[model samples]
Target: DPPNAHIEVSDDGQGIADQRVDGRYGLAIMAERAERIRGRLEIRPRHPHGTTVAVVLGPAGRRDSV
Candidate 1:
């Protein structure tokens, strides 16, 4: 069976300050995992707030037993 999963992360501390470009390692890791599992990751800014990161895991096709 195929299932859909959505993961969202949002914070309103400083709204992604303009002086921080050294904290994107996590995003890289997430992308790697997503690719390994045939998934995708999306990033966008939250309206009137901060940034939002969304990750979706697509279903893995059915496989027959060997």
Candidate 2:
């Protein structure tokens, strides 16, 4: 895998409310997926307005051939 990879998903229309940031199921799902893949997910406020979600997938370990 690459050293770093960023994925941004956002919308300007009615950005996520601060209260819902931690209550959203989607966000939780994202986190779970990241953990399953040995990666991490970060979420932060975007410039002006909106939320930014970034996911980084680290390199996979090499397996020894039998």
Candidate 3:
């Protein structure tokens, strides 16, 4: 809606706290890519389980939704 788009993924594992979480380049790379396309990336821990990764890009691309 509103010329915006959202992409999301989630898991049911132990989440970010239990993992080493440091010296990891995956998330960094993802975030950089998002910024390059004028988007935002988010990471959040699930209440009872894993993690959620989301990307939102908006106001600058094709608005048609299929």
Query: Best candidate per TM-score, number?
Result: 3
Instruction: Assess the local accuracy of residue 66 in candidate 3 as a C-alpha lDDT between 0 and 100.
Output: 23
Candidate 3 structure, TM-score to reference? 0.75
Residue 26 deviation, candidate 2, in Å? 1.5
lDDT of 3 by residue, 1-66 (tens): 563788999999888764556788888898988887878799999879899999888888544442
Model 1 local distance difference test score: 0.67
Off by over 4 Å in 2: 1-4, 20-23, 61-66
Question: For candidate 1, lDDT tens digit of each residue in 34-63?
Answer: 666666778777878888888776676222
Which of candidates 1 and 3 is the stronger one according to lDDT? 3
Per-prediction CA RMSD (Å): 5.9, 5.8, 4.2
TM-score winner, 1 or 2:
1
**Where does candidate 1 have its weakest 10-residue lDDT segment?**
57-66
Q: What overall lDDT, based on C-alpha atoms, would model 2 receive against the true structure?
A: 0.66
Q: Write the per-residue lDDT of candidate 2 for residues 1-66, one digit (tens) a residue.
A: 483445667655545666765455987888977777666788877778777777766666222221
In candidate 2, position 26 carries an lDDT of 88
